[model samples]
Target: METLATTEIEEDVDRISHLPDFIIHNILSRIGLWDWIRGGKEHHSQLLRLSVLSKKWFNLTASFPYLIFRIDHFHNVSRLNFFKYVEYATSRFCHHHNHVTAHTFKLSTTLREPAELDIVIKCVELVLNKGVRVLSIDILSVLGVQRYRLPNILSTVSMLESLAINGCYLPSSFMVNALQFKSLIRLKLQYISIDDEVIKYLNTSCPLLQDLEIRRCNGFKIVCVTGHQNLQNVTIAHNTQVERIHIEAPNLSELWLDERRTMQMNLVSCKKLRKVTYFGDLLPNSNSGFLSNFPFVDTLMLDTKCNNLKLSSHSLRTLVLLSNYDLEDIEFRTPNLASMYSRKYLFTMQPSVVSDSTHLKASMHCNPYGYIDATWFQKLRQFLDKKNGLEVLNLHIRTTCSLEKRDLEKLKAIELPPYELEHVQLQLDTQEESSAHRNFVDAVFWCCRPRSLILKSSSPLIDFEEQSDIVKFTHEKLLEQEDQSRTKIQIVPSSSCEAQIHLSDLKSLSKALPSAEQIIKFIKEEA
Candidate 1:
């Protein structure tokens, strides 16, 4: 019987191996082995293991068309051995698919010696010769090591569509000609030092370019992106040395700027802009409303320090407010807004919404240092008011101290208006004693009446025994109010399905409940 079963499994494997090349490739791609955006060392190893099944599988893996090599993947091997492995692997692939046009090739490693750098350049040239369209080379820089200089041979590849270079230095002569990047559509440069002239060259050279990103790069003071009618998305973030940015892309739709320092921005012609993310002090200093420049923007994310900020936009749909420490008041006049997320240190106030939309989902993350008082609950009630018609509310409360009995009394003394939500989730991170857990639950219930309360731990380091005690206390408290409120408690266990059981059933399955780490893992997976 064992021999018969083994023969059947081998026969099934043989049948799958005889499939057409396109069918096999499609099957492998479904596992994310050939995806440029998904594959990693694990996927590569899985592909190699699959190749050992048969010669047809080996050939298919060699001609996979998407290749990625990273030295960090081989941490147990020496640097020289890693390079030799790369050379041997690439040589085998190139030999098998001599005339095939590779779709993408990515190499990420650190080079301490000049010979290693030369070998990397050679590998890049070899990929280009194979007509690889998408090339990404991320050379990590050591503290005292010289930065890698981008070889000029890349400029000769007119068929390249997407190119990404990190931790490299681009000389002035590189990409100087306008005819170099004729087919390039996407370009990303990070941790690079390139002059302003090279940027100007790309601005005029790559007419078909649609996406451009320059992050944490230096040696360029002013960025003037103009005359690219096809450009749609532009991101310039964390480049503190950039003093001025002037963009005139008529077809541009998305722009993201995350600079710590103040800078001048001219986006007068970006009328088609639909989303804008600004993270700096540029908003408070602007003479006019910064959002007025892009009237068509539907999504906006702001991380700045402003006291009384007012946003009035007709096309706004989504808003994300992050790290606004000095924010006191916010007035929104977005009639079409549908979703809003506010993540900050503390919540002293909520945005005053003057919209006609009845459907809105709001999520908030509040990190309080010492303790949560009644005033915080009052502000939270104002934020989650019934007038907003919020469909769901996800609240993450992370506090360093526990709630006292007096705080709980004060919270209960303040009568909050009745507002029932469709779904309410509370992620708690506190160091309160097991006795104070009941007071914390009472304070939370006083703020809002949630039909279903989803409870989970916010911090992974929380003691499992203590967290289990908290959960048990919360279950008992909710059961005491079950007759009056009919609220159901949803406890998300780590390895099992979400059990929405009553406190009366705790004795029957108390040992089966998840630990703190399991709850955190489940929360992350859900997120």
Candidate 2:
């Protein structure tokens, strides 16, 4: 065994050593901008170790074009040693490749006092002098002093293509114009404050800016994007103090606004806008004129209180509506709409689209009293029947409590339609165990008649044994009906607020179809 292991190790090392230098450099060059930074300090250490492996590996790793310097990793080391280590690493990396330029550089540091902030500023200056196309700086003021300011030298990085800054204060004398940021295409600012002047510069100047994202920021109460030809996508989210927004970008294709605090908005002239997501609570007071400016919008999402939704966008292809209260009436004149997701209105309303098929996803909020009445099923059938072109249906039922066997029996006996459903998903409270809700599972399966059934519980404690009975019962019931053997059943455990489920759990159960230990191993691996 020892001889075999030694031979295998030698073969593996020989295989790697035979790879060409160009192939290795190509692999390293494709490492994404954020991937190296995601590993923190350990990633840089690994690269240093790789450089010492062999002569060829050393040369390839030394010319590495992307680097991230996270100084917080040295918080435990002596200050003198930390500076010496950084100086050695940076000098070695920056001075080795006289011809090759670093494409991306990221710096993350904590500034507890003036001295630390100054050191970080100097480090940024040094990396800038090395010439990088993409730069991201994440500076945190650990003492909450907020004294660290972005240096004015950033404006001189003429070759910069993308810039991102988080948790750093912009100086009051900050000035951005076309000449300063001409090459920048993408800009992201999070947890940073910028005033009206910067907002104006972003809208009128910076012609090459195509994609912009601003999250959890302040310093301006209004955002106006008008008359920009190159800008394509814009996203502004989670700004609590912003009260108003105005957009008149004729060339903009997509816009996303998710600010609950913004009370007013105007999309004056978005003639080429294709998609929009509006998530705000101040819809009742929304300007009707602003809502009418979306004649060319293809996809839209609105969380509004308007009882009557009259959308006349001929190009509208997708629509999603989320509202606290049920809408009384809705009207869509979109001829090309292919999919829609929304809460079912109190009364059945028909859309005026003329598509051959439409994919529909509906959400149902079950009553806390655990009432799954026949009327609810009748209404669903009526809604589906009125929409003749519905090729697929997905139901997301959010139940509040556990259900017993009787509830499943009632659902099985309901006069449900024979229409085929694509998928059915249930969300129950976390405290509700899977073993006690077999009836609820059966009811969803029988009532929806879905091609595939997904059984999800809020509790992670759900085991394979807990769902075996339901699986067996479903199989027995399906066998009683002809041509139902192809239906699929899947089990997943997820929290009420989450949608992700690990596939390993299902794989373990499938390998040993009727065993409890497999499920136990799955859960243990999860823990």
Assess candidate 1 and give its TM-score to the true structure: 0.63
Give the Å error, residue 282, model 1: 1.7
Model 2, residue 232: displacement in angstroms? 1.5
Q: Per-residue lDDT tens digits of candidate 1, residues 248-357?
A: 99899999998887777888778888889988776455623667767788888888766666677778777787855322355666666666666654432223321223
> lDDT scores for all predictions?
0.68, 0.59
Models 1 onward score TM values of 0.63, 0.60
Model 2 deviation from the true structure expressed as Cα RMSD, one decimal place: 12.5
Q: Candidate 1 — number of clashing residue pairs?
A: 0
lDDT of 2 by residue, 171-258 (tens): 4445554336778889889998887778887665466888888989988888887777778888999886888778777688888888
Q: In angstroms, how far off is 326's CA in candidate 2?
A: 3.2
CA shift of 320, model 2, Å: 2.4
**Using alpha carbons, what is the TM-score of model 2?**
0.60
Colliding residue pairs in candidate 2: none
